[model samples]
Target: MLDTQMPTPKPRVIAGESHDWELVIGLEVHAQVATKAKLFSGASTTFGAEPNSNVAFVDAGMPGMLPVINEECVAQAVRTGLGLKAEIHLTSAFDRKNYFYPDLPQGYQISQLYHPIVGEGEVLVELGPNDQGTPTARTVRIERIHLEQDAGKSIHDMDPALSFVDLNRTGVALMEIVSRPDIRGPEEAAAYVTKLRQIMRYLGTCDGNMQNGNLRADVNVSVCRPGQYEKYQETQDFGHLGTRCEIKNMNSLRFIQAAIEVEARRQIAILESGGSVTQETRLYDVEKGETRSMRSKEEAHDYRYFPDPDLLPLDIEQAWVDDLAAHLPELPDAKKARFIGDFGLSDYDASVLTADTTSATFFEAVVAASGNGKASANWVINDLFGRLKKDDREIAESPVSPAQLGGILKLIEAGDISGKIAKDLFEIVYTEGGDPAEIVAARGMKQVTDTGAIERAVDEIIAANPDQVEKARVNPKLAGWFVGQTMKAMGGKANPAEVNRLVGQKLGQ
Candidate 1:
């Protein structure tokens, strides 16, 4: 899916006092693996639990308790690597990254440095609209994916006089996905993270709930003068890329964009002022809307990485990887393409429906039950999605089930109820659950499809509007008004196609 030759837009240039500079961006997204237990312990990986309640001996890093690898966690990492079309290392080893922090129960955190689970991969990121509003797609390269253990959370807000450490998240499984500096703009950076989250969610390896800290990203941003990037490309020299400052633990997509803009502007101002940009780690302040230095950036040597002595190197079999690939479900891109080909959906509509696995499953179930792909897609995307947003609900929390929605669409297809009646039925089912057919029958909501009744209604409307009739006879486009008037008179229970037909026949169009 990598399309490096797809003509990219002009670099995102920042105008300086004398020269124009372009932005270079890379992201390190850390996604928590979805598992029932912690990576190295049997502790429950439940969120919102009492502090320290889920801790196990291994999770607490107690003396004489050695780390044990969770087989499911390792499998999840491999599955994620395959989903990204990355190369899986059959033999990989874990290293201890030494760092002293209050939240890290183990003085040395287990991570992969020289050997990682996954190798180079690429992702296609869809970005801004063209002149006609069609999105432009660009490809971003992934450097590697490594498995690591997460540090616990430090709480400083409970009481001003004290700081608390919550070890519930300690030793949890994390997949650090590192990206090459292929992103050229802030929007593209956000899009890359969004796409990675979507893919991981589809694979079921990660829930990708940014609000709950299940997924987070560290963005590396640099600014360089125009035409330097091409030189770097030719010589394969990273020096052509300006000094990059790492922005740590960004969760919100909006905040990611804002932080990138602020950081890039900060670097540009420094370069223009005859000051060399420093290589350091920084934090983005949401309220102040600026970037502040946190600490000096550390290289791999600073972490002092070494193979963990207690654990043996992991060696996976190709047959096992193939089995996992065989079991892999249809991914987002394939599903979107199939929806467009089979269901006659627009690209945008298919993209929206297939962005999340739950939404796509619900949509397909509705289509299967109703046997009307076009109508089913319209209802799910327009009516159901709109109502869910208004109620602040996710599709999983929808009051109306797919079977009920299919029932409503079925009634509309069978000519038992009009579209307007279907809308009323949807509202009823949403507020109070019941069968669509039963509700329609009990409330006498079916359309009057009898030809005699439809003819009579059409005649009355035409007789009442002779001027409109004349206008319609002369101008065929004006006949729509009569059709509208007749449907309005019938309380929206009249079959719309039948009404349009009778109106046209009576008006001699």
Candidate 2:
């Protein structure tokens, strides 16, 4: 129920200095539905499988084979639509898009064109920087979400003179979510994708794995005069919006931004040079950071879209939509607010922990087990997260489990180990998991909390460095060195405050 009739603002364009052109962008994101089977066949949706090993007869378009829709895929699409707050179509039908490709054994892809499954929705994309320097949010309108089958991949590296077709990906279920050209800048566009990915991950509908091609976007780029968008708003003329070119297969955020910028500049140059920007499909080269023409953009008629004859229209009851909505997981924004309010964490901390579902779950577990919110937050953000980044690992793949991490925090809180000693104990727990108490005992990493033991260590250090003591008695600043050495001699386990008190008493002026 978004307001598509709202006046679309015009972007700023400098005159003469820049030919006064505004870049208008829209995105069509193809997210592979997180289901075990293909859209029409029972073939495995696993990646990295041997070529053609995962395809079924229907996927290969064998004669007499009929398409059967996967119920799980339909449920997943509904789940995602609910997460996006989109309107679910009670009755939706599929269509056949006729096209010719070497890898498409069916010669036409089964997709939802005229009647999509999900209707208008809105996504709030963070635009500016967050409190922690992360980006802020911007609201973008969703045009529609349609279910479609993916085409097979064409591999050209198998032979020197010939190419090969891999149908493993053929007929994989995909949700082609289209967005309006409401995004104004490249940063907002990237943030929009990031937010969409986060939502899909939370909904458990899409894995959002860009590297493996589970999620990809097709960018629509157009240029207009600074005030032309306003005029289009008043007239509702699509032509006044200027011709648009589609950039295909943009998998990464960096490449998405770069491709949009380059394509816009290329179009601006053409327009400024008295040439028209051709409406076509183009490919983005990550290495070269440029887009090259693929082919002239095709219209719906070019594909000859027709109602799929083999499959019936999908019909779902309102009760089911209500059930899915009832079970929706705590989304990112809600979880972030809860983390901030319940744990007393800063907004930045909340944002970081809630960015990913696994990280947020892990943090909550550690805090609950340790019963120390602040200390647990510190360990999660500093110790565990630092190691995860250094080793290029994710929170789910951490070597240290939540219980073990909680044990470390508990030991530090109880004064059973000093901060420095606890770091070593953390390493032991991370590299070799076990009872933290046992690790501390095995390594003799107990803190010198007893006043007598700490005083003895401090006195011995002062006696060993008499000249340093004399300097400290006179300057009072040199006592810090003695304190450091005393702690170091005791393997960083001596109580630091007690050491300081003893050192100051020995160096009485």
Candidate 3:
């Protein structure tokens, strides 16, 4: 999927005082592994627990409390690597990244630097419409995926001066997916993260919940001249790309894009003003809509990474990885393609339906129950989804089940009810549950398909609107007014096709 030769869109250039500059962006996403326990402790990994309640002795870094690797966390990391279509290393080791913070009781994070469980990978990011309204795609290269333990939260706003530490999140397993500097624009950066989140959510390796801090990204941005990126690609020189600044711990996608824009502009302004862009870590101030310096960027030597003494290097058989791969569920890309191919769905419809697994499952169930593909897709995407959004409900929390919605679609397909009648039936089924057929039959909501009834209704409409009928006869398109009035006069119970036919016939068209 790594399309190195894929023609990229025009570079996103920021106009400097003298020359234009292009943006080079890379993202390091930290996704919390979906597991029940900490990576190297017996502590609970549950969110919203009481402060310091989920900590075990190992997580607390107590004397003589040795760390124990959680096998499930390792499995989840390997599964994520496979899902990303990356190379999996048979042997990987953990290292102690030395750091000091109040939230980090261990004073050092156990991470992988020398040997990561997952190697390089590629993510195919689907960008939004270009200037020509044509959707473009980019394949971003992933540099590596390393497993690490998360630090606890440092709460600073609780008291007047004193700060508090919440250790509930400490020792939680995380997979740091580092990408190459392949992203060009702010939108592309967001799309890349979105694709990564979607892939991880599909894999079930990570929940991809940004609100709960289940996923966070550290974005590194650098600005260069127009053609410097091509030179860097050819020579593999770091100097070609400008000095990079790291934006730390961005959770929201919107904020990530905004931060990149402001940060890139800040660097461009500094460079244009005859100043050098410093390499440092920065924080995006949401209130100010700008990035502020957090600290100087640290290099590998600053972490003092060394192999963990307590834990041994992990070695797994290739057979185990293969087994995991075999048991993997259908991913988002494959599911989207299948939905398009099997259901004859548009790309947009397939993308919308397959954005999440629950929606896709519900749509498939609707298709199965209704025995109609296009109609089911229309109802699911247009009617059902619109109603769900209006009610501020998720598909999983829908009042109408797939079978019930499918039953409504079946009523329309069988010509038992008109489209207008189906909408009313949908409301009845949504608010007050019942069989759509039974409700339609009990309420006399079936379409009047009888040609005699439709002709009489059309004749009545023509007799009432003498002036409108003259115009409709002269302009066939204006006959739609007669069709609408006739259907309305019949309480929207008339079959639309029969109404149109009778309207055209009576109008001498």
The TM-scores of all predictions, comma-separated, are 0.95, 0.90, 0.97
Model 3, global lDDT: 0.91
Runs in model 2 lying further than 4 Å from the true structure: 1-16, 130-135, 225-241, 459-478, 501-509
lDDT score of residue 359 within candidate 2:
93
**Candidates arranged by TM-score, highest first:** 3, 1, 2
Off by over 4 Å in 3: 1-7
Overall lDDT per candidate, in order of appearance = 0.91, 0.86, 0.91
Residue 27 in candidate 3, Cα distance off native in Å: 0.6
Residue 207 C-alpha lDDT in model 2? 96
- Model 2 per-residue lDDT at 294: 96
Which candidate, 1 or 3, has the higher lDDT?
3
- Candidate 1 similarity to native, TM-score: 0.95
Clashing residue pairs found in predicted model 2: 125-137, 125-138, 126-136, 126-137, 127-136, 127-137, 128-136, 130-134
Candidate 2 per-residue lDDT, tens place, 1-509, comes to: 11223333335353434567777789999999999999998999999999899999999999999998898898899888888889999899999999998989988999999889999898876554545654444568898999999999988888989989899999999999999887776767788899899999999999999999999999998888877777876887868778999999889998898898888888888888888988999998788878899999999999999999998998989998889889999998788878877888886788788888999999999998799887888899999999989999999899999999999888888889878888888898889889998888887888888888888888788878888878887898888998899888887888777788888887883
Error of 3 at 322 (Å): 0.5
RMSD of each: 2.1, 3.8, 1.7
Compared with the true structure, what per-residue lDDT tens digits does model 1 show for residues 383-500?
A: 9999999999999999988899998999888889988888899999999999999999998898999888888888998889999888899999999998898888888888899899
